[model samples]
Target chain A: MIIAFTSKGTDWDSKMDPRFGRTDYILFYNEDTQELSHLDNREVADQAHGVGPKTAQKLFERGAQVLITGNGPGGNAAEALKQMELKIFVGAGEMTVREAYEAYQRGQLAQGA
Target chain B: MKLAIASGKGGTGKTTLAVNLALYAAATRRVALLDLDVEEPNSGIFLKGKLKREKQLFRAVPEWKKEACILCGKCSELCRFNAVLKLGKHILVMPELCHSCYACSELCPENALPMTQKSLGFLRHYEQDGLDFVESKMEIGVEMATPLIEQTLAYAEAEIAGADLQIRDCPPGTSCSVINATRDADFALLVTEPTPFGLHDLSLAVETMRHLDKPIAVAVNRVGIGNDDVFRYCEAEGIPVWASFPHDRRVAELYSRGETLYDKVDSIRTGMDAIHTQISSLGGGK
Candidate 1:
């Protein structure tokens, strides 16, 4: 299945690839399954004060299965994302892009896939 | 004097303080209110002003000419924002990712890249009940608010140059747009509540003001609800406390209806006067 992972908060410019850190949206495609996954880095948008519901909706429409973020599944955002049938993962700290993908594969995410 | 009212966190009464201050100042002095919170500008709603679209602002994005273009990836290499993409003979420009630094055009070897203006948004002006205001509204779906804020600041500088006082209502957080809004202001008035979250974000706001080298004072809103952490921080850091507005349901009711705080709270006038006096004494009004 296609899976998308997003690193949120603190810009993470030096740790992650600069291209990945600056992107507000990321799309991952699985060639074998012909599936697409999308993620929105809400941390940057949150830093800018607030994120609109449209951003969350866009990720849902793009077929995101799970949203890997640093913030927990609570507050208004949790309820909003829950309505879209997207699983929320929190406490994913400082893991490399590949490591995060591996964690997803191992079913070690905070939210079950 | 240009006083930028800001807070690192939202829901801290930044807009309330700014609108009241502007209204109070406008009573005697000609005051202009410029809302630099382009992302979510609510000052107009509070002031109940009818906004007129003054001018639309645009920024230049690189447009590569296919006829004269080589497949050289120099443009992409030079763009720090990664706005330029080289795909064989095609060079695509993502306007959202562009910072308008024009580094790509400066480094283009074939001179195939020409900067073209893309509409970011518009600068709107309005007047209501003797209060003049200006706001920058970014085009819907636009990610960047920095350019629009910069244009708004420029407009404020040019138009409100000779005004007795100018109160700028800024967006939340200490990002580039917020920085641009308050960079040239004479003083920054940081409004915050007394909660833990308020104190946490107040520190961020302090750091930002220090970075900008702007003289700052704190305004504690909803004084009785939260603890004394904000006051303690102010006393420890030697940052002056300009004013304090208590947690009152009357104030909330007026705020919900877009009435200026000075009109709602009689005590606010005294605080505003003191703030004005303090600012003028600091030569901000000159």
Candidate 2:
């Protein structure tokens, strides 16, 4: 499963972004391969509207099975993510990417719809 | 000539000016009053007339067809608004994100996406003596106000084409909606107050009008309430201060009762005449 973390930078040491739709970066951690990938989402973050749905759609396209962030996606975006059966976990906005992954592993983060 | 009555700040009296001017101008020439603030169209609350016509308006949005789609994901890739998504062989369309730009529907390789009508708003026209009042009420929760304003202007152009002058009550502020309403006007009367916040926003609105290359003038409403900064700013910017209506207790009383002010107040009538004179100088008079 590829766990996606909304981040402020390109690496695991980067701070986790609290925002879902308008996050600066999307870090994907693959469980099987132990590989980490990052997608720059600066363009999507600056849009006037539909940022939530767009971000959700981008996650689904990138094969992100789970989402971890500070705050969850908004109404329209949550609906889109739900369509792809993507599980979302919230309350990691202030943590580093590595710390959020640890919390997700320990099942400390709250599950979001 | 079409004169748009707009303001940078709300409650600064764009509707007050529009209704009074249209009512005063109707004494001689045929006047058309269009309330283009479709989001909260309260101009109709003051101008009561016989309902002449009512029309429902629609905007075109793309609808995804399942069997016709080739699962190519082209439509989703082409959409800039993120309205379309390819989710497990089905291209789901979120109508709220659609700007109706037609790029997805027109460029679809399999012709799976087709444009369909979605409810935009409703327009109601009322005839009172020599004046024609048209108000557009946008559909609830519609964020974009530009398209509906354009449609209302088009309708007014066709329906009241014979009117000698048009007075449009615009949506407040310098947003895209305000630009849509005022872009085609021959002149824009920017109503403002005399306060600091009013002056700051008025400056922004004046800059917007200047950027659009539209001729603008100012009207300070609720006179004597705020400071003189708004007047000083207008003078420094070389924007003419056309009319000033005093802060009167009776004015508020009449407004609270949803009554027009032209016939009730002598000062309001004077303010209306001054605005009428300025517009007539621009060849609006028949």
Count of residue pairs whose backbone atoms collide, per candidate? 0, 0
- Model 2 Cα displacement at A4 (Å)? 0.7
Evaluated with TM-score, which candidate comes out highest?
2
Among all candidates shown, the one with the greatest lDDT: 2
Query: Fraction of true contacts kept, per model?
Result: 0.00, 0.48
What candidate 1 gets wrong by more than 4 Å, as runs, is A1-113, B48-53
Instruction: Give a tens-digit lDDT track for model 1, residues B1-286.
Output: 7788999999898887888888887777778899888988888777767765589899888887888888687886666554565533456666666788888887788888889998888888887756779988888988899888888888877876657788899999998888988998889999999999999999999999999999999999888997999999999999999888878898888878777778657778777887887877888555
Residues B120-155, model 2: lDDT tens digits: 889999999899999999898776777889999999
Which 10 residues in a row give candidate 2 chain B its minimum summed lDDT?
A: B82-91
Models 1 onward score TM values of 0.72, 0.96
lDDT for B50 in candidate 2 is 97
What digit string (tens of lDDT, one per residue) describes model 1 on residues A1-113? 44445543222231222222333555554546865444555444433322323344345546666665444433323333545556655445467555555666687867632
The parts of candidate 2 lying over 4 Å away from their true place are: none
Candidate 1 clashes between residue pairs 3 or more apart in a chain or in different chains: none
